[model samples]
Target: MAKTQEFKATERIEAPQGGPGRGAMGGGMVGQKAMEFVPSGKRLAARLRPDRGKAVLVVLLGVVSVALMSVGPRILGHATDIVFNGFIGKQIPPGTPESEWPQAVQGMDVVPGQGVDFDAVAHVLMIVLAIYVGASVLGWLQGFILNTVVQNTVRTLRQDVEDKINRLPLGYFDRSPRGELLSRVTNDIDNVSTTLQQTMSQLLTSVMTVFAVLAMMFWISPLLALVALVTVPMSLLVTAQIMKRSQGQFVAQWRRTGALNAHVEESFSGHALVKVFGRQEEVEAKFAEENDELAKVSFGAQFVSGLIMPSMMFIGNLNYVLVAVIGALRVANGQLSLGEVQAFIQYSRQFTQPLTQIASMVNLLQSGVASAERVFELLDADEEPVDATGAAAPGRRGEVAFEHVSFRYDEDRPLITDLSLVARPGQTVAIVGPTGSGKTTLVNLVMRFYDIDAGRITLDGVDITAMPRAALRSQVGMVLQDTWLFAGTIRDNIAYGRPGATEDEILAAARATFVDRFVHSLPDGYDSLIDEEGSNLSAGERQLITIARAFLTDPALLILDEATSSVDTRTELLLQHAMAALRTDRTSFVIAHRLSTIRDADLILVMEEGAIVEQGTHEELLAASGAYARLYQSQFTAAAVGEEV
Candidate 1:
C-alpha cells in the first residue's frame, strides 16, 4: 500500500460548539458556518416580490375579512342597548318619582317578560349573525388564496435549490457532507414551507386584528382604551427579553440537528464496517451524545419562548381587570352605558389575543429566517465554470497526451507535479501503482474533473480545455471497481450507458460481457430487478453489469480502473477476455492491482509519487528488473501462497 496521511493516535475529535450569541437552531457549529449569512431585509423582500400580485390579493381579502369581523362587537353592543332600552324605557321614565315608578312601570306596557322587544332584538341579532357569517367566508377564502401563494413560492424555491445543486462545483461537494446538504434541502426547506403555510397568514391577520380592535376600543370610550394601552409596553418588554434569550438557543438547536443528521448518515452508510468491527456500542454512544445535546438546546429554546404566552396572558388579564373596574365607574357617572362597557371588555380580549399570537409567531419567523439563510447560502455558493464559447470536439480519434501537468487538491500540498504521458489511438496503456500514488488523480485530470494549475492536456492534438466538458466526456467510457448500479431491471442498467439503446443492442452488449450468464439464471431473466446499489446481486455479477454498460456505450476511449478487483478468479478471467475484446480497436487506459491482467498490454507504465518510474512492454520490463519487475514478483508470490493455502 502507498504511504498516505492518517489520523494521529493522539488526535481527538469532538462535537462542534456554536459561537457567541448564535443559538442552537442557527447553523453554528464550530468550523460549521452559520446558514443565515444574509442580513439584508430588502433582499428577503425582493425574493417575495416575484409573487407580489398574489400577496396583494391575499392582503385585500384579509382586509375585507377583518373589516367585516371588526364591527361584530360594536353591532352586538347595539343589540345589547336595544334590548336594554326596550325593557327600561317602558318600566321607568326619566324624572319620575322612585316610589311611584313601580306603579307607573306596571301601568305602562311593562309586564315582566312581555315588556322586552323581541322584534327589535331579533332584527339586530340577524344583522350581527350575517356580518359574522360573511366574515367567516372571507376568512376561509383568504386562507385558501394565501396557501396557494405560499405553496407556489416554496415550489419555486425548491426548484432554485435543485438548479443550484447542479451548478455547484465538485469541490463544494468534496468539502461538505451529503447529510449536511440533505438537511438544507429537506429539513431547512420544510421549515420555510411550514412558516409560509401557517405563520404568514396568521401574522397578517393578527396585525390587522390588533389595529382594528384598538380603534374600536377607543371609539367605545377613550378612558378604557387608555387603560388597555398600559399593557402594551409591558407585554412588548417581556416578549423582547424572551426573544433575545431564545434566539441563540434556536441557532444552536439547528446546528446540533444538522450534526446529528450527519452522524446518522455516516453510521448507516458504513453500517457493515461498524458491525464488522463490533463498534455498535460506540456508534450508539456517539449518537446519544448528539441526541442529548440537541435535547438540551431544544428545551432551552422552547422554555424561553414558552414563557411568552403566559406572561402576555397575565398582562392581558390585568388589563381586563383595570378596564372592567374603570369602565364600571364611568358607566355609573353616565360617561358610558352597560352595552358599551361589554363591548370594550370584548375589544380588550381581542386586542391582547393578537399580541399573544404575534409574539409566538415572531419566534416561528425567526426559525424560518434561519432556515432560509441556510438555503440562500447554498444558492450563493460559487458554481462550476463553463465556457459556452468553447468548441465541441465531436468526431475525433482517441489520441491523448499530457505535458508538464501540475495539480493539487489544496494549494499547500501538491498531488501531481510535472506529470507527462502519451497514449495513441488503439494502444492500451496500463498505469500501475500502490494506493494513493496519484493513479486516480491522473485519470481525473484526463476527464477534466479537475483543472491543472500548469501545463496542458490534449486529445487528438487539440487542447482538451478548449473543448466543452460535455463534448469531451461523451467520447470516453469508464468502468470502475466500485461498480454503481441504480435500482432498476438488469436490462435498464445495461441500457443506461446509451439511454436510447434498442433491445437488440442491449442484449448484444450483455452477451458480449457475459452478463447474459447470470441473467439467464434469474427468474426474471434480463428483466431481473437490481436492488438499490445492486445489493441483491453478487459482487461479480454487479461488475459484469457495469462492464456490459461500458460495452453498450462503445466510446472512442475506455478507462478500466481496478475494474476486475471485486470479481472472483473465474469471473476475472471472463472479464479479462471481454475487456480484451472491447479494447481491440479502442484506446484504453487501465489502472490495476493485478499484474497478470495487463501483461499483454502494448505498453505498461509504473507510477510512484505522481511520476512514471518505468515504461516498457511486459518482457522488456521483466528483463529490466525495475519497479515493474518487483511489483510483478510480489504479486506472483502472493498468488502462489494463496494457492498453497
Candidate 2:
C-alpha cells in the first residue's frame, strides 16, 4: 500500500492556555482538522534532503563555515589569555603542558605555554576568511536547490488539488462552500509553501550547528559545558510551551479567514442583485460582521505568535548572563583559563541559536498545520458514488430510460418521485411542468448530475451509474434556458462543442442554428470577440449560438430547455425549424413553454409536484383531460380571449 503523509492536523482546541485552533488542545478540531495530511515527517525530510553529492559538498562547506565562526572566538580568547592574564609576548614557561589549556583534565594535559601567537592568529584568520568565502558560495547553491525542490513540490500539491476537484462528482460542487474550497486551494497551500521552503530547511541547518557548537564547548571545559547545558532543556521547554499556545490560535485564525472569504465571495457574486433590490446596506453589514470576526481571531493568533520571539529573547539573554558570570568566576578561581572561559561564552551563544529559531518557527508550524488540515479535509472527502467506475456502454444511437427514479434536494424537499420515462433515437420528448415541478431535475438526472435516491437510469440498456462520468457525458449535449456565451469569437464559441472541428463545420453549425445572420452583422463576423457571457449578443442571438454549439457536437442525446422562450415569434419560428432539423437524427429531450413549441412532440410528459401525472402525444394527452389537458386548455383559452380582443 502507498503510505499516507502524516502532517499534523490542528483543530479548535479546548481547555488550555492555548492549543490548536479553538484556544487549546482539549477543544478538539472542528471536523476533519484532526487528520494528518503530510506524508511521514521522515519521508518528507528525505525527499527534501540534499542528494548525496550535493549533501556531501554542502556539509563539507558548512563545516568550513562553522569552523570560520569558531575562528574569531579562539583568536579573541588567546588574545585575552595572553594580554589580560599576563601571558603575552613570551614563550610558555618550561613547566607548562603543551595542551595549551590552563585547566587540569583527568588523564589529559593542555599545552598552555601559549603567550601570544599573533603571527599564527593572523594566519588562521586568513584561513577563516577563505572558509567564510567558501561557506557563502556553498550556502547559495544549497539554498537555491532546496528552494527549487520546495517550489516544485508546492506546485505539484496545487495541481493535485485542482485535479481532484475536477474528478470529483458534480454534486460535490453543489454541496461545498465555494469560500472554504478556495481557502484550501489558495491560502492553505501557500502556507505549506512558506514553511517548507524557509523554516524546514533552516531547522535542519540549525540542528547541526547547535550540535557542533556543543561538542566544541564540551572539549573546551566539560564543567562549564555542563553549566551551559543547564539552560538547554529549560529554553526548549519554554519554546515548546509558547508554540503550543501560538499554533492553536493560528489554526483558528485560518478557519476564520476561510469563513470570511466565503462571506465575501457570496456578497460579491450577488452584488448586482443586491444593488438592484436596494439591499446594499444589508450586504455591507453582513460583510462587516464577518470581517470583524476574522479580525478578532487573527489578532489572537498573531498576538500569541508575536509573543514567542520576546519570550525566547528573554530566555536566551538570561542564559547568556549566567554563562558569562559563572565563566568569569571560574576563571578567577583558577578552574578556568581566560581562553577557556571565552570559548565557553562563545559556545553559549551557539546553544541558544537553535532555541531562538525554534521560537520563531512556531508561527510557521502553526500556519502549516492549519493549511495541512484543510488540504487533507478536501482530499479525504467521501466520493459521491461508489459504482461510477467503468467504461460507458457502447452505442452509436441514443436511448435513455429512467427506471422508477426518485430524488430529493434534501430529505424534506424531494424534487422527483417515482419518475419513469424513455426517449429513443430520432424522437423529441417534451417535458412540460410548472415551476418546482422537477422539469430541470429530470434533465439533471439524465446528465447524471445527481444519482437517484432510489432507482437506476440507463443509457443504451446499461445503468449510467456504472459508467465513468466523463465517458457518459461525452455523448450528451444541452442548450439551457439561461444561455451563457463565453468571451470568444462567434466561430470559437460554436466550435467549442467540438474543438477539433473544421472551420467549415463551425460555419455550417452556426448557419443551421441561424447564428450566421448575427455573425454577418458584426464588424469581424465570426472572428468578433463576444463580451463576457456573450453580453454583446441579443438574447435571441445568444440562444442561437448555444443551439449552434449543441448542433456542432451532434450528440446522440440532446437537451433544449426553454430554448425558444426568450426569442421573438420570428426567432422562435426559426428556432423551432432548426430544432426540428437537429432532432431528425438524434434522441432529444426538451422542456417547453410558449405552448406552440411542443405541438408536434412525439411524446409529452406533464409533471406536477415531483410526479409524472400524464404522458402521451399532444392530442392524446389533450383528449385524456389530465394535467397536460388542463395546461393546453389554459393556453387555448388565453389565445381565444386575445383573438376576441
Best by lDDT: 1
The sequence of per-residue lDDT tens digits that candidate 2 reaches over residues 460-571 is: 8978887877667778889998887778788888888899999889988988888887788789999999876676778788888888999999888999889886778997
TM-score of each: 0.89, 0.84
- What lDDT does candidate 2 reach at residue 575? 77
- lDDT computed for candidate 1: 0.80
TM-score of 2: 0.84
Cα miss at 617, model 1 (Å)?
3.2
lDDT of 1 by residue, 1-645 (tens): 112222122112244332111212222222235433237223444667677998898888888888888898898887777676567666555555545544323333233333467887798899989999998998898899888888888888899999999877555665555566788899988988897777878989999999889999988888788889999999999998988677666666666676788778878978999999999999999999888988897888788888888899899899999998998887666577668888898899999999999887866776777677667778888887774584857455788899999988767877788888889888999999887678877777888877789999998887888888888888889998778898889999899889999999999999988889888889989888887788889988998899899999998889998998888888788878888889877789999888999999998988887778889899999999999999999999988999999
- Candidate achieving the largest TM-score: 1
